[model samples]
Target: MNWLKSGFELSFRIRPVGIALAALYAITCWATWRLSVDQFFLPAGIRVAALLLCPPRLWPYLILGEYAYFAQMRYPMIEAYGLGWVILASACLMPAVALIIHLHRKAMEATTEGWLLSVAASAALVASALKLGLSHLLWPAPPSMPFYSNAALFVLGDYIAILTVAPLALLWMRRRSGYDWSVWRLPPTLAALCSLCVLGALIALVGAHDPMARALLQLLLVLPVIALTCMHGWRGAAVGVPLMNLMLSVTMPTTGLPSSFDQTTFFTQQIIAITSTALLALGSRITHHYHQQARPAMEVSQAIAFSRSAHLANERDLRERALGLRRIADDIEAALGETAHLLRANGHEGPATDLLRTFSSRSQQFRELTSRVYPTELEHAGLYVALQAGGLREAWDSSHRLVRPLLAGDPCQLSMGLQLAAYRLLAEAVLLLLEEEKGQILIRARCGRSGGQLGIVFTVALLDRHSTLTPATQGLAIERLSARANAYSGAVQCRTNRIRIMMRDTPLDSAWLAPPRDVSYSSETSARH
Candidate 1:
C-alpha cells in the first residue's frame, strides 16, 4: 500500500498527464452533487482548490471537466432556467478563484501565517455575490420561495462551501507539494480528536430530543477549532473547523436547525469563520512579538562573540611581537659581546671598551622600549607590575600622582589578552593625566565575577579641579581607552576628569597565542638603539 502511494506521488510529480487526469477525476466526483436552495455546495471547494494548485496550462482541463459536470447537473433546469444561465453560473466562479489565486501568489510564502482567513473570506464574499446576482438575473425562482430568500440561500451556501472546504483543500495540496508537516504538533491533533469525541457524544445524547442541548452542542463545537487555531495556526483551524462543520451537518437534525437551513448554515459558517480569524490573528500577533524580542538579543550575542574573536586574534599578534622582540634583543647582545672581544684581541682596548659601554646602554634602552610596547612583566607577574613600571610608582610616591589598586581576584586566572588590555588602558589613562598637568590622578581597579562574567573594572580620576584637561583631550583619551577595552569584549566611559573601563576576565588558552614558526626576527639585524 505504501509502495503504491509512493509510486502514485512520484508519477504525479514527474508526469503532467497524471496531474490533469487527477484534476478531472476530482472535479467530476465533487461536481456531481445536486444544486439545491439550502444545502451546502461542494463543487466550489474543488474548483477553488484546483484553480490554486494547478498550473495555468492545466486550467483548460479543469474548466472542461467543470462544464461537462454542470451540463449534466443542469439538464433538468434547462427548460426552466435556460442553457445560458447554467453556463454563466458555472463560469462566474472562475473570476473569484482567479482573484484569490492572485492574492495567494502575492503573499503565500512559508514564513507568512494567518493570511488564510482573509483570502478565504475574500474569495467567499466575491464568489457568493457573483453567484447570487447571476442566479437572480438568469434563473426563475420557485413560487413558494421569495427572490430575496433564494438569493440569500444561494450566497450563503456558496460562502459556506468556500470557507469550510477550500482552505483544507489548499492545505492538503500544499502538503502534497512538499511543505513540512512536522510543525503540526500534538496539541492540534489532541484538540481535533477531543472535539470529534465531544461532538459525537453530544449528538447521540441529544438526538433531536432537546432543542436547547442541540443548539448548545453546536456552539460547543467551536472550542476545538479555537484550540487548533491557537496551537497550530491557520492550517489547523482550516482543517479542524471544516471537519467539525461536516460532523455537525451529518449529525444535527435538519428541522431542528435555526429558523431555516439557510439561516442555520449561514450562522454556523459565520461563527467558525470569525472565530478562526480571531484566533489566527492573535496567534500571528504573538509570534511576531516573540520574533521581535529575540532578534535584538541574537544580534547582541553575535556582536559580543565577534568582538571576543577579534580580541583573541589581536592578543596572538601581540604575543608574537613580544617574543620576536626578546629574541632580537638577545641576538644583538651576543653579537656585541663577540665584537668587543675580537676588537680587544686586535690591540684596540680603548675603542673596544667604549663600544662595550655604548652597547650596554643601547641594550638597556631597547629593553625599556620593548617593555613599554608589550609589557613582559604583565605577562609574567600581572597588571600591578606593569602599572608600576617606568617611574609610574615613583611619581605616585612623590605625590605627583595618586595610584590605588583595589584588585580582588588572582590576576593569574585571567586571560593574557585581558591582562594586556587592562595594562594598556591604565598606562594610557595615567599618561593622559600627566599630559593634562593634573596634580594627582586616582587609580582604582578590581577584578572578580560580576553578573556571570568574570571581569575587571579599572577607573582613573583627577583629584585636582585645576587640571588643564580639555574636552577634546578627554574625548581622545576615552576613545583610546575604549579601543583597548573593546579588544577584550569590554567598554569604556568618561565624564569630566574621570574614566572607567570594564573587561571580561575569562582566561584564554595559551595554545591560541602560539606564534608562527615560519616568521623570524633576527636580533642582530632588526634591533636598533
Candidate 2:
C-alpha cells in the first residue's frame, strides 16, 4: 500500500501535465463506459501500459481509448441492430460528444465557470435529448422501465454521472499528485476543478429527494464549489464536489423507479439536468471575474515591493557617498586655514598674497558646496536656493550667457534630499557645457502647480553647436540628474539636446532649511588648475 501510494504521488507530482493526462484518462474511461463495463475498465489498463512504455505519447492512447470504447459498444451495437442505421447513429452521437467535450474544454480555459457550466449543461441537455430520441427510434424496448422512461431520464442520468463522477475523478487524480498548472496546460486546473465541484454540489442539493434529486443536488453544489475553487483552488472543489454528491446520493430516495421508456419522467430529468448546467455556468463566470481582478492587485503589490527595495538600496549608496563628502570637506577647510597662515607668516608681498587669498577663498567655497550637496542643508532649503548657495546658478550666470528662473511661484515644498539632488543635477549639466567651450547655456528652473501635483522643471539647452557636447558629457550629467530625481520620487530624462527634470508635489518641512554642520576638507594638493 505504501509503495502504491508512493507511485501515485510520483504521478501526481508532475503538476498540470499530470492533471491534464488524468483528465484525459477520465474522459476515455467515461467514453468507454458508454459501450460496456469492460470497455470502461480497458482504458485503465491502457493508461498503465502507456505509463510504462511511451509516457511522452500518452495523449494518443487517451484518444484511442475513446475510439476503442465507441467501436466496441456503440458501433457493434449498431452493426448488430442494422449496419446502415446503427453506424449512422453511432457516427452522429460519438463524434458529437467528442466535439462537445473538446469545445467545452476550450471554453473552460477562456472563461472560467461560465463557459464550463454552459458547455457541460448544454451537452447534458442535448445529449440527453438525443439519447432518448435515439432509443425510442432505434433501440426502444419496454415502456415504464426505469432506464427507458423518456429522453429526460436518459439525459438526467448521463448528465449527473458525467458532472459528478468526472469532476471527482479528475480532481482526485490531479490533487493527489500535488501539481501546479504553470508547467503544462494554459488554464488553471484548480479553477476547472472548483467549477466542476460547485456545479456538482448544487445539483446534489437542489435535486435532493426528487426523482432526479441527485442530479439537481450536484448542479447546485457546483455553484459554490466553483467559487471555492477560485479562492482555495481546484483541490477544495475536487474534494467538496464529490463528497457532497456522495452524501446526496446516499440520502436520495429510491422509492419508485421510473420506467425506462416513460417519456414524461425522462423529459423531467432532462429539464433538471439542463437547468443545473446553466446555473453552474453562471456561477463559474462569477468565479472567473474575481480571478481577473485578483491578478492586477497582485501585480501592483509586487511592483510596490520592488520599488521600495530599490529605494532602500539607493539610500544606502547615497549615505555612503555623503560620508565620503563629509571627510573631503573637513580636509579642505583645514587646507584653506593653512594656506592663509602661510601667506601671512611668510611676509608674502603683493602677487603671492593675492594668489594665496584667491586660493583660500575658493577652497572655502568648494567646502560649502560639497556640504550642501551631501547634507540635509540643501534638503531643508529645497533645490532652488540650494543651487543658488552652491554657486551652480551663480557660476553659470557669471560664466555663461543664460541662467534664469523661468517661473517663480511658492517655493517648492519638498524634502532636503530632493533639493540637494536637484542642485547637483543642475550643477553637473552647467559644468558639462562649460567643458565644451559652449558660450550660451540656457538654464531654466521653474516651480508651479500642474496635474494636481506640484511640478518642477529644470531645463538646460546649449546655445552653441549641438554637436559640441560629447556623449560622455551628456551621459555623466544624466546619471547624476537621474540619481537625484529618483531619490525624490521624481525622474530626470534627456530628450534631443535638452535635459528635463520633473518633481511631483509634496509637503515641505519648513525647518529643513535651518543651517546644519559643515564638513571642511584639505584640497591644496588636489586643487584644479
Considering every candidate listed, which one attains the maximal TM-score?
1
Compute each candidate's TM-score over C-alphas: 0.56, 0.41
> Which candidate leads the pack in lDDT?
1
Model 1: lDDT of residue 219: 73
Question: Measured by TM-score, how close is model 1 to the native structure?
Answer: 0.56
| CA-lDDT, candidates in order | 0.63, 0.49
lDDT of 2 by residue, 1-529 (tens): 7877666443423456645665665576554343321001222223322332233344444444444444554453543344543445433443454455555555534535344344444555555555445544564342233444334334445455455455544444335444453532334545555555565555445544454554444345445545544444444443444444444443333322211122233343344445444444444555467569987986755554454346445544775776687677678667766776776678765655676678678766775555543544454666656556654445566674765555455554644444445566667777766775355777777777777766567877765535345577667766766654654556766665666788654433122222011121121100100
What lDDT would candidate 1 get against the real structure?
0.63
- Give the root-mean-square deviation of each candidate in angstroms: 18.8, 21.2
